[model samples]
Each structure stands twice: as structure tokens, then as C-alpha cells.
Target chain A: MVMPMDGQLLVLAQAETGNALGETAPTIEVEEVGEPNPLTADEQELHATTEADGDAHHSDVFPPFDATTFGDQLLWLAICFAFLYVVMSRMALPRIGGILEQRKARIEGDLAAADYSRKKTDAAIAAYEAALAEARAKAQAMAEETRTSIKADIDGKRAQVEQDLARKLEDAEARIAATKAQALANVDEIAADTVQALVGQLTGEVSQAEAREAVSQVSKE
Target chain B: MADPNTVDPIHQFAIYDIFTLGDTGISFSNSSLFMVLTVGTIAAWLLLSTAGRKIIPNRAQAASEMLYEFVANMVRGAAGTEGMKFFPFVFSLFMFVLVANYFGMVPYFFTVTSHIIVTFALAMLVMVVVIGYGFARHGVKFLKLFVPAGVPGYVLPIVVPIEVISFLSRPVSLSVRLFGNMLAGHITLKVFAGFVVTLGSLGFLGVLGAVLPLIMAVALTALEFMVSTVQAYVFAVLASMYLNDAVHPSH
Candidate 1:
């Protein structure tokens, strides 16, 4: 509120405060304010002679500063607010979303790699076991083959030796038979000679037939 | 008649209330009508001005471009590049407050800003939004705004509380400054004006006094205009500062 033409300070006109007077001015210019900005002498002398008598000054009731009663409700109707919020969240948000999704995917991809590593190791382990098993089976098969070949060689050598021994034995048997036959033939001749000798001692020489007969009679006696 | 507030400076404003709705207190006054007028004017200006935009825009489009650039440069300059994010908010604030203030000087329309209800409301709204935004973005980190950079171990008992008080008083001081400036300016304008009419019949001295008051009235009006724009800029800049504080609370 503005100051009055009179040289009095306003006593703050109020609607309901007890200390405040109504529309009417208070009795005496109480601490009156005017061109004399209660703070200065130059302003005071400027309006020193304006008001006369006991009136001293003319003052108006000043309004109190109502901090509580601030702002018009209409100004804050929040008109179009919902639409603005939606625009900001929807249209504006999508532009910056790539980073968030990328970060999530990167982390998830790392996790997937970690998980995949286990499976890979397990597969490699299985492959390694399979390779090891194959090697063992191959060695066993080789050893078995070596055993069977050695046994076959030994059996072939034994069969050859048996055939050679049989041949030798047969030859030996033929030789013995020849020798015995020769000996028997010689015995007869020898016995005939011995008988001839005995005859000579007694009476003189005998024929071969007579000798064989004498040998035979001597054999009988 | 002798009351300081006897003459309402804006009474002559030709805008008037056409009717009232059964005392529902929802009566649309001249001021309310003009507020709508301001909003519509801005909308039309934006739409029509930008209707046929081109790479090298025509006059209408250029006008829109200038306005946009003006707000952009201001935001960039005051709030830096980071402030660009709040361009829409600052731009809207400037347009609304600028229009209201310029229109208030139109010799008839009521200055909505002259009322504490308007200025304080805007201040509080900004505060709530800024605080809400910081919390939404950084959660509890916003509380660090009250924490100072350095002090002493012993001073914590005193410094922390004082800093907390200062932070809490932000909205109060902001609203009060704007409200007080507008209110005081209008009151001074009204007071000087009363002299012109009341100094009647004092002859050449009266004429001389009337002339001095007239000159002062014009000068003050020009000053008020400057003040209106300044206040809007200050309000916008402070809002940016608050945002910066939220972004870098430890600072």
C-alpha cells in the first residue's frame, strides 16, 4: 500500500487483528511517516510544515504481510502437467535407453560366457577320457596280436622237429635189420668151418653138405 | 480519502468482470480474463509463427526463432551447457512473466505479479519441482547439498546447523524478494500519483509540484519495466543454480 498525501505514517489497517484500527485513521499520527522517510532529516524537513494543529499527520492502516496467503490456486491448476510428464518419460526416455540395455546385456553376456566355460570343460573332459580309453584298447589289442603270432611260430617249429625225428628213426630201424640178417648168415658158415676142423682131426677133409649135416646133428645132440 | 491506499493505481484498467456466479468465489475477473489472453497470445504466436518453418525462415518464423534463441542463449550463458536441459522450463517462465509484466504497464490491466499470491506461488512451485527432480535423479544424495566442503571438527556443531538453515530459507528469500520489489514499486507509483490530483489549486507551485510528480511517475514506470524483466531473469538463473546444486550437491 502507498503512503498518503498527509505527513503521517500508516498504522496498518487490518481486517481482524485487534492491534489494527479499522478504515479510519488512528487518533494521533503515531510515529507518523511521510516525505520524511522516518529514516532521514532531508525528507522530514520537506514536509515539516504540511500538516497543522494536533492532527500532526494523517495515517492509514497498513496491511500485514501475509506469507501464509500466497499464490492463486488457478495459476497452479497443473494444467497439461500429466501430458508433459508423459512426454518427458516416454519420448525423452527412449533416447537414453541404449546404454542401460547395453550394460545389462554386457553383464549377462559375461555370465553366459562363464556358464558356457563349464560346459566346454566338461565336453573336453569327456573327449579326453574317450581318447584315453581308445589308446588303452588299441594297446591291449596289439599285445593280444603279438601273443597269438608268437604262439603260432612256436607251434610251427615243434611240428617241423617232430617230422625230422620220425624220418631219422625209420632210417635207423632199416640199418639194424640189415646187420642182424648178415650175422645169421655168417653163423652157419662159421659152424660149418668148425665141424670141418674136427673131421680133419679124425680122418681127413669133408664135403660142404656133410659139414652142414654134422653141424645140424651136433646142434641136435 | 486520506488513506495511503485510497487510490488503486490499476483501477483505471478498462478490463472488467462481466459477471459473478452466485458468489461461488469462482468469478472470473478482468485479471483472470487477461491471464487467459496472455496464454492464448503465446500459443498463437508460437503456432502461427512457426507454421511454415524453413531452413531460412520468413519474418514470422524468424520472430519465433529469435525468441527461441534468446531463451536458449540465456540458459546457456547463465546455467552453462548443462543448463540446456532446463531450457523449456526457463523459456516458459520468461515468456509468461515477461508477458504479464509488460501487459501490467498497459494503463488498465492488473499486474498479477503485484500480488504475493502469484510470485510466491511461482517460487514455491519452482522449489518443489527442483527438489523433487533432484531426489528423483539422485535420491538421498540431494541431502548432501546442505553439507559444506570444509570447516573444522569443532565448528561442525555450529556450521552444520547454520548451513541447514540457509538451505531451508532459500524459497522464502526468493519469493519475498520478488514479491517485495513488485509490491513496493506499485505502492511508490500510486503514492506519487496521488500528489498530482491532491495538489490542486495551489497555483504555479501546485503546477510545479504536479509536473515533478509526473516526471517521476514516468521514470519510475520505466524503472519498474526494467525491474520486471530483471526479476524474471533472476528467478530463472536462480532456478538453474538450484539445479546445479542438485547435480553437484557436494559443491
Candidate 2:
């Protein structure tokens, strides 16, 4: 029986007191302490003498069939275990669980917010690209319209300038023609006078009609 | 110098009554004191660590959270998600056993787990929970746990009794494994320590001889610490396994 035999158990109880002295004394004191509790000094001596006879004490830790302390140990164990269980299940574990849940929820919420913000950024980029394309198209159309309008304005100005130049040329040509005809008439009169002088000098019988007819024929040619 | 033979290696495991109830035989003993201390320390450490409840945990909080997650993962792995319902029980058992085992390593302190009675009680609690939950959840079908699937019906008579005995022995095996490991380790440590004191007393050569045992004691102490932690982990893992069996009786 793994009985907490009085002798063995007393040795345990006196261990602290045994520590007070030198190491050697403590070891010897431990044996004496075990004997003193169960019997008077006289019986202890008898028992010590028996122990000294080298009969090994029934010191097997797991001695056969000892039921003495089982009741008290079981009772205490149940009490302690119950207390521990209640505290753990009711209070401690739930708190940790709640904290973990909170952390998980917080992480999920942050991820969701990140996802939402990312989507908003994508939408904004898309809108910006659309606006940029529309602005490019509008600028292109305005440039085409401006180029056509400017080309038309230049064409109209060129046409009007050409017409004005043609009119000026025609007027100048008519004036020049008139001047030539007047000069031709004067030349005929002078020629007639000159021819009559020359003829008188050369052959003193030239007629006025002959000079006029020569001048007229030359003018006609 | 004290005689070396006087040092009792088993002295540390003895229980002493600090205060006794009148005629009831029920008393507050050293074992009870350490048990209370173990629970109190666990409670205080966990509560204080989590008091701030910050999203970003502080050092103390981080340590506590690590332990929590470790045990949590252990349950989830062994028992699956459904087994998580019993997290509190498993966590409590793990922490209590772990704390008690480590606390035993402190010089002159009592080891609550070293006692067979205490370990047996804890084991019984696990067995009770497993059986109770199994029946509660599965009803008569829980008996199917003992009957292996795809077995010849002729083998039922032989296998059923063996399965029942194994099932019944779970608590015994569980309790004894922890108790035996702790008891043996502590005894071995005490015996080696006794060698240190005895050898040192034998004069010059004796002191030289003491060094070897001292070194071995140090090495064994390190081993014991590992054993303590591993045993606690094993206890929790086994409990979770049993709970898994309970939750899924068909397997």
C-alpha cells in the first residue's frame, strides 16, 4: 500500500527544519524526524534498531493497496478542477475569443474599405480618360473648322484682288491706243510739209496733192 | 556532516496537513496549497495579460496569447472545429498541469501532479466528459465506437470486450502515465542530489566524485523540464483525442 506511512510522511514534513543545520545533520535528522511522530522515544529506539537491522522499509512509492488518502485527494482535486473550469470557460476563454473576433472583423473591414477605395480610383481614372478623349475630339473638330474658315477667307480675298488688277490693265491699254492715234495724225501733217520742201528742192514741180497722197498711202500701210 | 542514508528521496512527495477540520479528517494540506497556487497563478497571469485588450498585444499579452493559441490549435487539430466547443476545458487542463509540473521544479515546493490520486482525478474528469458527451451526442450509437467497422460478425464477441477494457483503461493509463513520469523524474533528481551531498562529505576524493553527479543532476534537471512540458502537452493532446472520439463515435 502506498500508504503515507507515519514514519515516511514525517520525514517529508520535517525536511524544511532539517535544512536549517549543516547538510550532514539534515540527512541524519530526516531519519530521526520520521520516527519521533508515531511513537514515544523508547518505541522509536526499538524501531530504529529494527530499521538498522537493514530490513528495507516498505518504501515503494506505488505500494500495493493503499486507500487512505484517496478520499481527501479526490475531493480537493474536484474542487480545484471545478473552480479552474468555471473561470476558464466562463471568463478567460470568452474574452480571448472576443478579442480575436474583433481583430478579424477589423481586418475584414479594412480590406473592404481598401477594395472600395480602389474601385473609386479606377472609376475616376476611367472618367478622366473619357474627358481627355472628348477634349481631344473637340479640339480636333475646332481645328478642322478653323482651317476651313481661314481657307475660305483667303480664297475670297485672292479673287477680289485678281478682278481689280484686270480692270486697271484694260484702262491703261485704252489710254495708250488713243495717244498713238493722235501722234500718228500729227506725224502725217509734218511729213506732208517736209515732203513738199524736199520735192521743191529736188525737182521744182512737186504738187501738194501728191505729198498728201504719199503720206496717206504710207499711213494706210 | 549528515549521513547520506538519512536523506529520503520520497520525502518531497509526502502530504502534510496545515489545518485540519474538526473531526472531519478533511484538512488543507501542502498538496492543496500548491494546487490553489497553480490555479491562482494561471488566473492572475491570463487576466492581467489581457486587461489592456489592445489590438496590438504587449509582451505579457503576447505570451498569454501564444499559450492560448497553442492550446487552441492543439484542440482544433485533434478534435477538429466541432471540438472547439470544449476549448475551455482542454485549455484549463493544459495550463493547470503545465503550471503544476513546472512549479514542482522549484526547490522545496510540492508537486501537485506527482500524486496518483490527483492525476487520477483529472483523468477521470476527462473520461467522464468524453463518455457523457459521446452518449449525449450520439445516444445508443455511441456503442458503435467499440465495434470496428467492416469486421466479421464472428469476431464481435472477442473484439467487443477487448475494446471495452481499453476504453475503460483510458483514465487509468492517462493518470498513471503523468503520475509515473513526474514521480520517477523527481525521485531520480532527488537521488542524484543525495549523491552530491554524500560524495562531497567523503573528503578530497569525495568532493571530486561529487562533480560528476552534480553535472548529471544539472543535465537531468534540464531533461526533467522538457519532460514536464511534454507530459502536459501529451495530456492535453490525449484528452483532445478522446474528445474527438466522443464527437465522432463512428470513427
Candidate 3:
């Protein structure tokens, strides 16, 4: 397909160049009778060179389709590709793979470290909470113990005060009984004196012994 | 029809001798030069960028690594872990085609992959490896690739030939796809660019008229870039899939 197209292009280029040359030849011939045009000569040269280049390229053959060049292309491709394969497989690829692997390993290692740090932080938090709970429990237990000890001391003091109060009351009641008896004896003597006074006032001091004997006999009864 | 003097679209595909190889018909050519350039570019990019091997990648290093992993994953995905053995081969093919395609995008640069022979050679290499490795690994069982598991006996006569033909066409399709895309794209771009040049010479109005083609050329350039990369990826993917067939031929 490309071969035919190139052939057509070649024919067209030749035809166009031929027409240009044919047209310019008359112009140049006519101009030569007067003065040769430098610009026209330059154009002629350009066309000639282009035509020559077209011919050199094998006007009928497309470059890609040119079977003659295949050997060189293949040879060079083999050399270059083989060199490439070697360079890639041995040098370039391995290094790249290593870089990738190293990067992956590094990323994984970093991730794992981060995970470990997170775990350690979690453990620390757990330990802290455990210690906090233990301290709180210890404080609660100490408070309970102090409360019990203070209550026991207060109870003991209250019991001792009650016992002392009972003993004091018993002593006071005994003393009161002794005083009452002495007061009753004094009452009897006073009654006897009053009776003696009354008797003295009435019938003289002769009655003192009689009044005392009467008061003593009445108390005994 | 373009004036051959002003715009020879096919002129770009021409291979001229830079030097000769001792009277042998095999002379080094522009195609060869571009091939070397391709190789050099790939090697330099990969080697120089990864020379740092920093855990945190710079842009070039990241790009290279992305390419590596992309091809690696492609091989592994298509052919499985066992296909990783051919990772280097696939990587080489991918980079070669990719870099060659990109190189072609440079103005006035010879496109190595645009030639049928170059792409065909690369495809042949892939097929050779696949067929060779398949037979070596699986022996006569490699023929089982043509015989799918669930096909009925009667249908196999039809299915088997189709499978064989498809298998045979792998190189053809692979090579032609890259060659055709590169050739057509370059030519189209050249023609459009030629339009701008041809039209712009006419006058101010012609210059104004050339804007459409100029825009088209620009858009085509971007599209060509995409096509180049995509074609390379396609070639690698197909190669890996074919390798998969070689590795596990039963399917």
C-alpha cells in the first residue's frame, strides 16, 4: 500500500519539477538574452537538488517498506535491544527493583514502628489507669481504717465515762445516807433542847432529862 | 496531496546510513541511532534516578519505581508468581517499546518502533521466549494450550484451530499494533503540521486559517503521547498474558 503511494508521490514530484523546469527554462532563455536572474537560478538549483535527493532516496521505494534497509535495521535493533536487555536486566532493572523493594521495606518498617509505638502508648495508658485505680482503692481503704479506729476510740471513752459516773453516783448516794442519819440525830437533840427550853420557860430545867428520854423513846417506837 | 518539496510526511521514516560496516550491506542507520538513544534514555533514567535509592523517592525516582511496579504487577497479575521469572524480560520489552515510542514523539527523531521490522523483532523475541519456555517447562503438554479443558470433542476440531491461529497471530497483532499506531500517529501529526506550514505561507488569512490545524496538531501531539504509553502498556500486558499461557498451558 505504501509502495504505490510513494510511487505516486514520486511521479507527482517529478511531474511538478519537470513542469517547473520546462517553464523556467523558457524564462531563463528569455532572460539570458537580457540578464540572468539570480533568484530564478537559485530556484532552479533548489528544484534540481530536491529532484536529486528524491532520486537518491529511490523515488519508487518508501523508506519503511524498503526491503534493502531491513538487514541494517535488524542488525542494529538486535545490538541495541540486546544491549538494552542487558543493561535493563543487569544494571537498570535490578537497581530500580532494589530501590522499590528498599522503599517498600522501609515503608513497612516505618509502619511497623509506628504500630509498635501506638501499642506502647496504649500499654502505658493501661498501666497508668491501673495505678490510678490502685491508688484510689488504697486511699479509700485507708480512709475506712481511720474511720473505724476513731469510732472505736470514741466508744471506749464513752464506756469509761459511763462507768465512772455510776461509781460517783454510788459514792454520793452513800455519803448522803450518812449525812441523813447525822441530821436525824441532831433533830432529836434539838427537839430535846426545845422541850427543855419550853419546860424551863414553863416548869424549870428539871424536865431536860425527861424530855430527852421521851424523844428517844418516840424515835425508837 | 502535499507538495513533496514542502512536506514529505514519509520522509521522516527514511533510514539513511550514518556509517557502514566494512562493505557489508549492514550500515548503522538513524533507526539504530534512535534505538541506542532509547536504550540510553531508559538506562540513564532508571540508573541515575535510582542511584540515590532514597527510601523517600524524588520525582524521577518515584516515576521510575512506578514504571517498575507497574510492569511487575502486570507480569504477576497476568502470569502469576511463576511469571515473575520473566519479570526482567517483560520489563525490558515494556521499557524498550515505551521509551522508543516516546523518543519518536520528539520532533525529527527517528521512530524505531514505527518500522514493522523492529516491532516484529521485539514481538518475535517475546514469542520465542514464550514458545521456548512453554515447551521446555511443560513438554508435549505445552500443546495443551490449544486444547481448552471444557470444549467438547466435536467442537475442539473447530476450537483448536482457532486457538492455534490466535496463538500464532499473537506476534503479528503485537508487532503491528505498536508499529501501526506509531506510524499512523506520526504521519497524521506530520500531515496536520504540514497543513499549518502550507497554509501559513499563503498570507495573513492563510495564517488565520492554519489555526485549526495548528490546534489539531497540538491535540494530536498530546494524544500521541498517550497512545505511545498505552501501546507500550498493551504490549507488556499481552506479552505477560501470553507468558501466562506458557506457564499454565491447560487453560
The best candidate by DockQ is 3
Residues B1-251 of candidate 2 have per-residue lDDT tens digits of 14675666776776655665665546667778899999999888888888888788889988888888999999999999999998999999999999999999999899999998788889998999999999999999999999989889999999999999999999999999999999999999999999999888899999999999999999999999999999999999999999998998877
How does candidate 1 score on lDDT?
Answer: 0.59
Scored against the true structure, residue B99 in model 2 reaches a CA lDDT of: 96
Query: Candidate 2, B17: how far from true, in Å?
Result: 0.9
lDDT of 3 at B36: 86
Error of 2 at B29 (Å): 0.7
**Any idea what lDDT model 2 has?**
0.80
The list of candidate 3 runs beyond 4 A from truth reads: A1-57, A203-209, A216-221, B1-5
Name the regions of candidate 1 deviating beyond 4 angstroms. A1-221, B1-25, B58-60, B77-82, B150-153, B200-205
lDDT of 3 by residue, A1-221 (tens): 24355444443344333333333233233233333334445433442332323423333345665444566677788888788788888987888877767777988999999999999999999999999999999999999999999999999999899999999999999999889999988999998998788878897675677999978988899
The candidate, 1 or 2, that scores higher on DockQ is: 2
- The iRMS of model 2 comes to 9.0
Task: Compose the digit string of candidate 1's lDDT tens values, residues B1-251.
Answer: 34433454433322223444453323344555556665556656665655554444678766666666677677777667866777666666666666777777776466656655466666776778678877987799887776677766887778778878886788887777776777677768766776766664467788777888888888999998998888877777776677666555677
Candidate number with greatest TM-score: 3
Clashing pairs in 2: A1-A64, A24-B1, A24-B2, A25-B2
lDDT of 2 by residue, A137-177 (tens): 99999999999999999988888888888788777787787
Ranking by lDDT: 3, 2, 1
- TM-score of each predicted structure versus truth: 0.52, 0.81, 0.84
Ranking by DockQ: 3, 2, 1
